[model samples]
Target: MQKLRGALIGCGFFAVNQMHAWNDVEGAVIVAICDRDPERLAAVGDQFGIARRYADAAQMFADGGFDFVDIATTVQSHRALVELAAAHKVPAICQKPFARTLSDAKAMVAACRTASIPLMVHENFRWQPPIQAVRKALDAGAIGEPFWGRFSFRSGFDVFSGQPYLAEGERFIIEDLGIHTLDIARYILGDVKSLTARTLRVNPKIKGEDVATILLDHEAGATSIVDVSYATKLGTEPFPETLVELDGTEGTIRLSQGYRLEINNAAGTTVTDVSPKLLSWASRPWHNIQESVFAIQQHWSERLRDGGETSTSGADNLKTFALVEAAYESAASGSPVEIGALL
Candidate 1:
């Protein structure tokens, strides 16, 4: 297997983990790194031991001769950079939200399709060990036939300390943070028939809503209530927790507040913690989607080498982006919106 020489376009806060993950990947190596900020670029380059560095994406793409490019930049720049990668005939693994708008996401997918290059958006929340475990549990019928489920992320994790731009963005949880949760719901459940969402701006300073509650109507007749909040300020260790509770006809499972699950039926009560946990980065209870970098990067490397699509391809992620758009429309119109209409 040929090792894919990689180039990271952004050396911002989260890029650090992606770089580290690339180094850890068996058949991939980050040959080049680029960032507008020299100081941050130098710091990341020095830490990662990469010799090739560029201040611009074009120069990096031209000079590095990378097999694949990692666009870990912001949402606003994803389309242009990803298009640049496609033009360069380099497979791209970009960071999420795939783009600021659904149209931009569609354009990115089309551009990559036109160029015959693989385009993957790094939507890694569902790849996290705990979420993956929940996925496995659901598949194994540990929670029986999942009729309903909730994907909740309530935290005051001070995410702005690193990415301050999120504090000022016009899109809130559903588009930004909740986007991952909504996609997880879709992955665990199925295609959404329609959805009604209400957004709340608890934080006065930010332009977007700090909290949102989404009512999802899946095609399989499962009703899911997805709640996402960046304003949860609990004075406890479990303050910033992701709550996932699913109830089926035969059993029920819950994960949150120290992760307790209970199942009751003729088979007797089965109660235990179903939380899929891993080593925390920086602080405990790592909630950032960035935590799944290793999983996402490994998947990217395998797909890039084996000639397959990523776990979160731009085209596949269209459904996820549609959910975000529908949430916004539903919130604005105070009505349930059809997922297909957004497409």
Candidate 2:
């Protein structure tokens, strides 16, 4: 099989993990890299040993040498970069939250569909080992006919230390972190029918709401609660861990702290450790997320090579992105927001 040459745009904090992941991917390589910041571009280029580098995206697209492009830039730049990739007839993998707004996301997807290029949003939380374990248990009927669920990600970790811009955003958690948890809820339960939400800002230092609880009515008749907070302080911090509770007709499945998975049903209770494998480049606390980044990127490479649509293809992620939009609307209006109407 011929290796797929991929160009990575953006050399930010998270992009380093992506660069490392691309190195480990079986059928792909980062032949080129682009970043607006020369220092970042040079640093990543030197680290990855990528010779081709570009300061301008248009220049990179014009002199395209790679088969696909990975846009790891912020949300504000996603639509433009994806559209540029479409124009260049290059398959694209964009980081989430896919775009600044639902309308922009829809337009980006439409552009790629028109160009007949595969477009994937980097929604990797569902690919986390523990999360996948939960999904597998659901598929195996360990939890039959899931009726109610809760996806909770509460942490007091100082996220601002690494990404100071996070604290500056007027729309913080829901757009930044909650989007992942919301997508995870949709992944486990099903597509949502409607969503009602409430938001609060416990930390006055930040501009946006630090806490949000969203009530989702799933199309499959299951209801779910997605709650996220950066203000919750615990005896032992569950930073970066997503704790899940699922109740089904047969029994229940609990994905607890420390990657512990428990399933209770007619066969009796079974407990297992579903911890993520710590990659050599990964660190403690963030290893789970780092591992997921690799898993999703590998999935993208395989799907692209096989001419198959990715799990988080642009068309599919619009449904997940709709939940983000619905959550904010619902939180502000104090009413249920219909998912269909927004999508």
Candidate 3:
């Protein structure tokens, strides 16, 4: 198989993990890198042994020599970069919180569709091992007919230390973090029909809400709650772990803290450790996320080569991104937002 050459457009904090993952990927490799910061571009290029580097994305795309472009920049730049990729006829994988707004996301999707380029939003939370385990159980009917579910991500960890920009955002947890939980909810239960949300800013220092609870009515007639917080202080601190509780007609599935997945039904009860593997370049608490970054990238490579639709294609992620928009709209108005109406 011919190797897929990928050019990455962000050389910042999280993009380091992406660089490492791309190295470990079987059929894809990063041949060029672009970032506005010359220092970051040099640093990541040296670390990854990538020789080609560009400070301007426009110049890099004009001189394109890669099969795809990975847009790992923040939300504000996502739409422009994706459109740029579409214009250049390069397949793209963009980092999430898909865009700054639903309208922008829709436009990006439309641009990609018109260009006939494969576009995937890097919503990697659902690719995490434990989360996949929960989905597998539901599909296998370990919990016969899931009727209600909860996806919780609570942590007191100081995420602001590594990414100081997080503290400066006008929209914080729900957009940056809850987006993942909401995507996980859709991935597990199904599509949402309506959603209601309430949000609060527990910490006075931050500009955005630190806590949020979302109630989702799935089109499949299932109800689920997606709650996320950066303010919750637990005994041991389950930072970055997404705990799940699912109730079904004949059984239940629990994805508890410490990556323990338990399923109980008429057949019996089984508990398993569904922890993510720590890759050589990955560290402790972040290993699960790092693993997922690799998994999603590999999936993109396979699908791109095989001409199949990505699991989180731009069209599919529009639904997940809509939930974020709906959450904010519902929270401000104190009413249930109809998903179809927004879509």
Candidate 4:
């Protein structure tokens, strides 16, 4: 089978991981790249051996020869870029924090639908090996109808060092990190019915909240908490790990900090190691996320080739993106925000 040709826009910090993953993906290869900064563009193009580089996205789209376009730009450019891809009838994979607002996400989805092009958000947290294992266990009835759960990611690691723009944003943790956790919560426990959130800005140096605790009422009557904090300092920093606790009618599931998965039922308790594979270009702590990037990109390639809908399709991601918007709304109002209303 001929590999699908892909074009990647925005050669930033996270985009490098996407580029590395593209190299690993079986069915796709990035043939072109675009970035506004000539120096960064040249750097990534040189690093990845992608000779086709453009300083403007529009020019790249005009001269496009690729099967799909990966929009790895930041949140602000998401809608415009996705719409541009849709205008060209190119299947697009957008980086997470899908859009600035739920409405913007909805419009992007509509644009793609009208163009008859596939649109996937790079919501890779659900693609992580451990997270997928938890979902698989739930599917196999290991937990027997989960009712209560918690998805927690707390760390003091300096994320701003690599992406200093993180500290400058007025909306921080929830948008940057918690978005993944929230998506995982939805992926495991099902869609949220309502959400109530409280946040704090612990680090004075940052403009946005570093700590956030959110309560979610799942549509299937399950209740879950998504708590994330960049201000947390632990002896053993979990960093990018998302610890999960799931309680069900028959048993429970726990994904601990050390990539340990424990499942307890009436029969017995079983402990297993559910660590993500360290790819050649992936590093510690971030390998889990890096692996998921490859997984999701591969999935996009397969789905685009097979004429099937992607798991994190724009329509589906609107629900997850809604949680982010609702979080801020709830944090400000000190009241529960209805997910249905936001959707």
Deviation in Å, model 3, residue 159 alpha carbon: 0.4
Better of 1 and 4 by TM-score: 4
Give per-residue CA lDDT, model 4, range 131-229, as digits (tens): 999999999999798999999999999999999999999999999899999999999999999999999999999999999999999999999999999
In Å, residue 90's CA in model 3 sits off its true spot by: 0.2
Q: How accurate is candidate 4 locally (lDDT)?
A: 0.95
Arranged by lDDT with the best first, the candidates are 3, 4, 2, 1
lDDT of 2 at 20: 93
Q: List the residue pairs that clash in candidate 2.
A: none
Residue 238's lDDT in candidate 3: 91
lDDT of 1 by residue, 288-326 (tens): 344477778888888887898787899989998999999
**Candidate 2 displacement at residue 267 in angstroms:** 0.8
**Cα shift from native, residue 1, model 4 (Å):** 0.9
lDDT (0-100) at residue 31 of candidate 3?
Answer: 92
- Listed in order, each prediction's TM-score against the native is 0.93, 0.99, 0.99, 0.99
Displacement of residue 264 (Cα, Å) in model 2 is 0.2
After superposing candidate 2 on the true structure, give the runs of residues whose Cα lies further than 4 Å from its correct spot: none
Candidate 2, lDDT over the whole model: 0.95
lDDT of 2 by residue, 262-332 (tens): 99999999999999998999998989999999999999999998899899999999999999999999998
Q: Candidate 3's residue-wise lDDT over 67-159, tens digit each?
A: 999999988899999999999999999999899999999999999999999999999999999999999889987888989999999999999
